[model samples]
Target chain A: MSTIARAPEPAKASLVNDPKVRGLVYQAVLVVVVVGLVWAAATNAVENLRAAKIASGFAFLNSTSGFDIGQTLIPYSATSTYGRAFLVGLLNTLLVAAIGVVLATLLGFVLGVARLSSNWIVARVATVYVEVVRNLPLLLQLLFWYIAVLRSLPEPRASVNPGLGVFLNNRGLFVPKPIVEGHAWIVFAAVVIGIVASIAYATAASRKQTRTGEQSPVLLVALGLVIGVPALLWIVLAVVAGNPIDFDMPIKGTFNLRGGLQIFPELVALTLGLVIYTAAFIAEIVRAGILAVSKGQTEAAHALGLRSGPTLRLVVIPQAMRVIIPPLTSQYLNLTKNSSLAVVIGYPDLVQVFMGTVLNQTGQAIECVAITMAVYLTVSIATASLMNAYNSRMALIER
Target chain B: MSKRIASLALAMGLGLVGAGLGATTASAQATLANVKQKGFLQCGANTGLAGFGVPDAQGNWSGFDVDYCRAIAAAIFGDPTKVRFTPLAAKDRFTALQSGEVDVLIRNTTVTMSRDTTLGLDFPAVNYYDGQGFMVRKKLGVASAKELNGASICTQQGTTTELNLADYFRGNNLKYEVVAFATSDETFKAYDTGRCDAFTTDASGLYSERLRASAPDDHIVLPEIISKEPLGPGVRQGDPQWADLVRWTHNALLIAEEFGVTKANVDQMVKSDNPEIKRLLGAEGSYGESIGLTKDWAVRMVKGVGNYGEIFERNIGEGSRLKIKRGLNALWNKGGIQFAAPIR
Candidate 1:
């Protein structure tokens, strides 16, 4: 009836009928919404910044820090620039993360393998450790270790020495620091060359064995090549230079331990907490990786006259690694990021030094927070890339 | 039917999200204004430290720092009980103030240059004069800080004490390895276990900590004052009115002490003929209205909590278990820096 005055209809939109156009519109709307939210946040930040008259920029990084930090790996002082302070914090974070990763991995592998042991007692003990450590809240564990264990130790004068020139006081562990003399670089270079040579030879030997049925004693050969050269060089250097390396062991003085490197109780506890906490997670990963390997494969190797050690070294581990590595990277990243908790223990870590002191000094929150986040993200990404490459290499060779 | 229901649900979800965002923006913007309208003053304080801020068995906050919180509450709301104590740590204290989490920081915080400038906080007045001092086992036969060389000092990190330990040791050429903890309590505990040869912190703090010891007299605070630590109450900068209100409230305790206005006599002193007294007690007007407060705010503070000296005596000084002397916390008129600006 209304056709007498009919006008051509404008297109009515439906989400499904034209998903391309619809998706474009929806995406455009999302972009606008995101941009608007960002704009609002930035505006609010600017207003607050202006109200407080706080300068919002990175210029403060060049400003001299009027405060000082203890135990800086690089040169630092009250006159050090904010940038220098940031580097110190980053270095400390790397230090804790590096040490924690190594110790945790070692502990994890041992526990994971032990949990699968034929010895009932060993398996039960490993299982108990894994369950207890993994289930506990990391922060509570850290506090319990720091306050309940380390801080409860006796003072330095009444310190408990556990041999090896190591002092165990509430202050921390003081141990011998090896001072490497000039010719030490030669030993270090030799070790590096030895390692590369060993790896190259192992790869060739493994490839040859994989192609042919002939066997190569690769593990023994590699160990001999890698360790042998370094030991020989050290001996030669020692004989030629009279004293190639000297040990500066901590000796108790009237009021303090003098001459050796001292690791504070806070640091020791933090490392312990980090290792125990990370090891639990790493153990889970290791377990998963091992289990991912088919049980039938291990049985087959044993049926074919192979022992558990040889089967594990050659077959089961290679398969298990594929399952283990991705998760392993995540755990490693977590350990690195969680190292920020060192601030609570006054470990002078990256987060504590850079974000805590530098932020307090410069009052440049936006820049400082951004830089710290970027560093952590970069480190995590780099670590992940490395592990991923290893994982890819260790992956199965499919027909 | 299913398709129709899906569209309706999506539309409703979008609508709800839009409403939520609108509500959040409005609430965040009006936070500062809402605080004033609410009438109660919010004060941030330390969770537990002997003389600064500690919750008793009944959970009532009672300490020198808590008293200052009450003073601000009294000044603003005319009721000291109107305050809400938000416990904060050394690291989170400034952020809490900046984020409008609290109106004032009365946490026995040391006034430092970095805190003053970078934190965008204004330290209106110092309530306590403190200095870094060492505490050692009395059996060590250490009488003064200078007597201890090569001491394994337990120092709290993220504090000025760490830096001062280095300075003191370096200045005296006394080599020491510093064992650091995140909290003062932990640092002291380390020393208590004989893990450190000495424990170092503020002199006033050491006195309070000594009282909490398993045996109070087992440790003695050495006489050597390493560095000045002027502990004070601070508030956010930029709000001059707010800053002045907090400052005047802090300074009143000192002013009241100087004028002999005790809790016992404040009611009588309110009607005194002295021009300073008249002006301070609200017998005169227009002075406090400038800071958006009543003229009787000073009288309310003095009456609510005794003067700064009275607070000190009750919490940490000779009247308390700490038995700390009024060596540096005395009124400016009697040789301290607790000076109050005149009401005029």
Candidate 2:
């Protein structure tokens, strides 16, 4: 213990036996192997492409995509470039993901709360739904929704008129689109003006309540301002400006419904499948978040003479969101990624249009696939960062 | 799921690497020699094309393209059973051939200029002369493709038919909606379910797919052939000797038909004194050996899978359920485009 040489500093633990040095060496080896693999793969790709005389570059993106996508959110044609095709595919994917997120969140919240309800039937039913739906594969559920439900609808010639100028058929759901013209700008201006007034009124009313202890009917006033202003402007435009809003009603021809908006069955099926599938998982997350809130909070609210609705709304949801945000973010990402199953049902999402048809037509597999991966990576990163921002804002504070 | 896609990407990367390795390995030696060394032929075929390369319930493949592979095996080993099949999708067929995963690809692929020059593959000969056509319900009364204005056509996505349909419609100034599915079976399903007014594909495919329709008699294949689709077998580009062997193997089948050498009558005709027949059957000279084959290779192929005419009738022609008449697929002397080069 007191040796002056100290065994020559224990031989410096023999670099190999030193924990830190060993760790560094292992990590260095791992990195080198990974880099070597990647380098070999890249070189192989380059060499093979050159040997095959298949050009390897993104120049093929400018080439004409001579394939037709079944459903496109933006304008697309066979003559359109692969660049435009990729953009259309991206927009379609975003459209579905955005809509699916909104619908899934709303439904998931309702189902989660219902699952915790005192009513036995409601809670049991909610539990059964969550267990059953969450257990099935998303692709299988998608196929079920697409084939068994949507595709089984009546054919166009014998379409079911759901009334109000809407036609439901195997091809699509055709609805009348309002073709705004002339004085519609005045109506839009009134809506903007009303929204501004309502916001000002709400802030003032809330400030007054906080300062002077006077309850104002702010919600009623705000709703009245927004809706009444828009309705009055629309009426005045119709009366004085000769009917500004004209609906282009769908005309059911012998074989099709034309002249109005046509929502392809592909979109309907994909949205329905995504919504139903994602909501089950989101529901579980939401329930876990709600349950994570301590029972003391509810009891404390009750002791303060607060009603159940106010106590839950004012106390529960805000606190539960702290636990919910991170997992909820992941669920949203999963939903977005799962939307790629649109390829199977032919909904023409990013993977379907860009990664599939474009890759096949151009035979530029490397570039097309790389572009697709980059896009998904971008989408995932963007979504995660946005959610992370919200998460940090909601994170708990300690003194 | 992303991991699965990543692994798939890795596999594709390795495929490119394999392709580069194959190019170097294949360029130095004939694929014929490689096949001989391997002791069997590896043929790339369709994943599942009706009457083309579909496998039976027992997993034994038997189709037009399947038979062609068997003929190749027969030519090499005089045993048709020495061939193995690799089912490939439309997207990966060329890669399979270019990577040396298969000795030949007879997957009913259309021969085009870009495919010939680009993809590092060679189209030796056209076996099936096809063209894009439309099949509509008989009740629609659409006799020709020209009449199908404002029609909704169902087609498989990422296929030549999709482009052909667009071109035909644009050329004819017709407004149409295309409902594309991922598979021909799905396209047919959509068409059968009345989701589309018509189904479009190659003429032969139309004939075969029509038989799968709920009411086969209710659908009528339109008379108009929109675009020429010369379907053929393909091999890797670097191997000239291998390409020659595949080309002659196909040619031998055609020439055997021209010489009236039936599979049943091949043994008898091999003894014939006709110079052309004698030369073709290996009784005259060593024509087959030049392509790296035995002297009786043509005899083995003829006896194993029969001639082109017999194979055609058995798989996709009048003798099959498809009952597709030999229009463009008939021999040149019989008013068709199936003309082969002289064996000598």
Candidate 3:
């Protein structure tokens, strides 16, 4: 009875016989929609702009800000050009993104692995963390951290000293700042050289494994290249050149814990919020990707005389990565974009400093807004291009 | 991870493009007529600044800034009840106005040359004279602004207060670190929490903020003012007629303040000997006709709200909790800058 009711209907033979007419009709509708919408919007904008007499151009970006940013990353004042001001905003945005990315990755990987652990309490805690944080709104979390947690701290001078002179207060988290001197160049150069040598060794090892089925000592040799070369270089450069490294620690002051870098409450709150919120989403993605690798595959690896560690490194992870990379990149991009919420915590990020504050002061809404949108667009586009390259690199090579 | 991530990334890329387009679309080309015809005037204002724009026990808004919104509405329609107030944070205030989300911004917005041109808005007349100052705990023994040189400052982020603090400090060769929060409430908390040595803002705002503190008399406002902030009402650019109406409505209040006119006496003063007052009151002049208004327009405004002085005194003056004096906000004849263009 179901089969009779759901029997196939006769094929629509009209479109097949007149494919040319059908194609032309669809194309005509598409063209009409595109042209009509464009024309209507263009006409409306022209009339509005004319009525308002607002000049549309990029000249305003070169005008003097005539206002000052509170915490500019670079030297700035009322006399600085709007162009430089915009650069300051971009730098702040990049700073937030970079910090948030590092923190979110570390937090995410830890909790992701913990969620899969043998200890019941640890796994449950990780599960609860992922569930609670991921379900809440990021903006609300930022506000909660800023208003409730940070605002509840004691006064500055009565700052809660946790340990090792690290002070926490409503003012902000104050830690000892390291002042890097001019002579740290040779050591840095040695470290970069070691990284390059390790990459070279790893590539050769992978190629040798693919060809001879005989695994090269890539991990040990690469580790040696990374650590041993840097240590040897530091010893040679420092002893031969008699270079000295200075130790400049923060000094206790009458008022503040001065001389060290102070991470204000706004920044601390925003980064902390971004990390917790982003890590939750990342955990889900990590779990799904790990699960995508079948249990049969793991059992097969065991039957082939492989231990759990070797099985993971050689067989499981490589296949699991095909499921992981795409969602992971999406998470990275989302984190980058959501960093704009720094405005809520007053983190002096790109949108808050330049587009919001500067635009208010200068009244050059057209140029200022355009520049801001263009910057975000360019950033996302570049990030997508990089993600694409990474995605392609990890793709399976099919016959 | 890689394949599904690539697809999700593509979908995310589309979402970002949509968001950018959506933001640009809102206020990209808002016209002057659309705001007025909409009936509900979108006025950007503070949520709850006592004596400026705060909600009463009944949840009705009343204060100096709130009154100005009523004045603009009164001028637009004979009724002053057509306003829809949008409470905005310092950072989002101008954006709301710029996006055409608000018709005219009557917040405690400062009138600056940069804003007049670059912000795509027009300031018709200044409604108040504000200057940045510091408020510290009285027990701190900081009587004068000079004592605040080495002190940490708590100020709302994304505002002129931060820059003013820096200017005052650097000009005096003083050193300070600013503890900034995104909202005024947060800044106050930071100060009350003892994160900063002093709380700074326009003197008028300090008066109001201090009134709400845990112990009101515990803090004292310093004498030195750091920056000139001519707080004014703003409207989007491109309608000279509308701009003229808002400008003159503000001036009518100023002129009324100058003429010693109260809301109750505005009708009685309409029959005065002063040509300026008579002409302003619309007895023998057509000032309103040329500006697309009735001659009795000024009379309605003065009769409704009296003048800037009346609004100031009734809301935030000596009789109020703020106990603010008419310093720079006084009329020019009274040795202040509250002068308007001639009513004639």
Candidate 4:
């Protein structure tokens, strides 16, 4: 056996020349620099605030907020604590953001599908809508919706009665508010039960279809159980004990409507503006996502004797979702942040009620601003993580 | 990686905290010296209140508050043109003064205990004795503010007017919705377009805003004055010299008006034999020197913007379209509460 000459053993690198040692040293320096900067900033702020004689700290949150908000989702008054006022504003912001996200997504999917239609008029209309809406600044659109569309409506005295105890005017759309009297919890329980039953039925149906190569109308069954059970229970409860729910209809007062759930024109204008603007961008995103799905997939589905609808729904959509989700997450976050613009129209969102009125009243600018920033950061991170979890589930599993 | 992220987040949080605190640096106590060094006086005025601090089509500011700024500039530099106006909203006025963006704030601010103590600001003198009031459309036939129950009221945000509206309505046990806007213009416009049944603000502001309405005669000012709003100029605290200079400048205006000294006749009155006028005009005592100004300080002020009466008349009184009468703002001897300190 020929013995191969072994190569000389390599010498160990000096500490300064070693990549791992150099990286460690650089990281240590970076950490020290960062800590020093934070310390300096904190001390500087403390000194300046003390010198200005401006009261600092979070104690002001307990003080009374002697200002009224336009819209309050919870029990709030001028005598409420600043902390409670902050909560009211936060709820209002979340309400608008949640409604805006759901509505914009539904409208965007429709518009996206229309943009790819074989018909010329349908495609052109969708394209024009996207271009015109996305090009204008959101602020201008908001102003237009508020000043031109809503403000042009007549006064409450001349309000348009759109039938069914509803009034529409510049002040707001007044709809009869349902007041639950008694045994309403029964109806709620029925809804929960119906939902659980439908989910279990859907799972069982899917398993049967996979095993026996048979399909079931799972969606129709689920919808029927959810809606039918709730309606049946509600009607039975009403018949048995007078009425379980009563609607408080609005009455015309001397100056305006007195009762009912009055949606402020500011809220309507803001929601309309946000949904329209954000939908345009989401429509483009959806169209791009659909186009990213390879054409060969659709051909293969058709070759397997699947119809056009099944080919698109089963073979195209699932794959397209993988591409759409990441960008869609960003749009959702942008919509949520843009809700701060409610201040301009007096919607009493977080910025308007808390950052504007509360900060001005307490004169604790640092604490108020820090709280607002932290709230937004927490909300954004929560939204992103939720989307990331869904994205990972939708991710392609490679063997 | 998680540790790195935690540090990054900490850094970002500290940076934001720093930014919020850094914007409100305690300005040096030498505001007057800084103004002189900069060669121009930065005066914070209203964004657009018709008779108080509105800018013209040519961007020339001319209002009661604007004239006060010009008077201060004239007192310091002997030139009324050496002043720059910073138009501020109701919410931004105190911040602007505290941050030293403006040497003084004459934005028709109300003097209140919290503002004086907590906001680190000082009100030199009450320049306009105004009161918060309500204005409603005449077509509504609402005779008094008491009849405005269940009404939607419009007001500017971050003003005492907002608080007073709440207090008044809550005290009377009435239900009313408040739609507060950021600017006075928006508040008035919302009221004009019938978004609100009534508009609540300082009576002076109500009268001024009426002029901008499509039909100025349709609205009527209610008889009730809800709250006392002693509108005045504001300056930062910790600068006693600057505060004194601003306070004395307002006192000089009142004295000039009391002595019947007008802008056009100031030069002729400078040589008068009256001891009070002599001292006020910088002829007898070195009052101006105590405030680090030239001897002709009051004379320059009067020459630039005239007395308090002239300013009120030109901007919002009989000489202007507002035609607001001198009700409570008249001098003490004239059956009003406007009293000035003795120049002697």
Q: Is model 4 an incorrect, acceptable, medium or high docking prediction?
A: medium
Candidate 1 per-residue C-alpha lDDT over A330-365 given as tens digits, one digit per residue, 9 for 90 to 100: 999999989898876667788887777666546666
lDDT of 4 by residue, B1-344 (tens): 48646754785757655664565455456998989999999999898988899889999999998999999999999898899999888877776777788899999899999999988788989999999999999999999999999999999888999899989989999999999888888788888988899999999999999999999999999999999999999998888899999999999999999999899999999999999999999889999999999889999999999999999899999889888999899999998888999877
| lDDT digits (tens) for residues B1-344 of candidate 2 | 57545555555555545434444433324788789899999999877778888888999998899999999999999999898999876666765676678889998889998788866778998899899899999887778888877677888776788889988888888778887766666678778878788899888888878878888999998889999999999988877898888889889999999989989999999899999899899998999889888888999999999999999999988879878888888889999889989978
DockQ of each: 0.26, 0.37, 0.27, 0.56
The residue ranges of model 2 lying beyond 4 angstroms of the native Cα positions read A1-40, A196-201, A212-215, B1-30
| Model 1 DockQ (Cα-based) | 0.26
Candidate 3, residues B1-344, lDDT tens digits: the string is 56555445444444444433443444434333565678756778886788999877876888899888887776556566777888887767766765577877787877777567745578887888898888998877777888765567777755777667766777887767765556787678667766677899888999999987889889888989889998988877755676787788888788878887778898889898888888777887888665676887777777666688888999999988788989888888888888799876
Residue B114, model 1, lDDT:
75
- Candidate No. with top DockQ: 4
The residue ranges of model 1 lying beyond 4 angstroms of the native Cα positions read A1-40, A68-70, A147-154, A158-168, A397-399, B1-36, B112-114, B147-149, B166-174
Give the Cα error of residue B137 in candidate 2, in Å.
Answer: 1.7
lDDT (0-100) at residue A364 of candidate 1? 66
Q: After superposition, how far is residue A227 of candidate 4 from its true place, in Å?
A: 1.1
Candidate 3 chain A weakest lDDT stretch, 10 residues: A45-54
Report lDDT (CA) for all predictions: 0.77, 0.84, 0.74, 0.88
lDDT measured at residue A77 in model 4 versus the true structure, 0 to 100: 92
lDDT of 3 at B142: 78
DockQ, candidate 4, comes to 0.56
Q: Order of candidates by TM-score, top first?
A: 4, 2, 1, 3
Ranking by lDDT: 4, 2, 1, 3
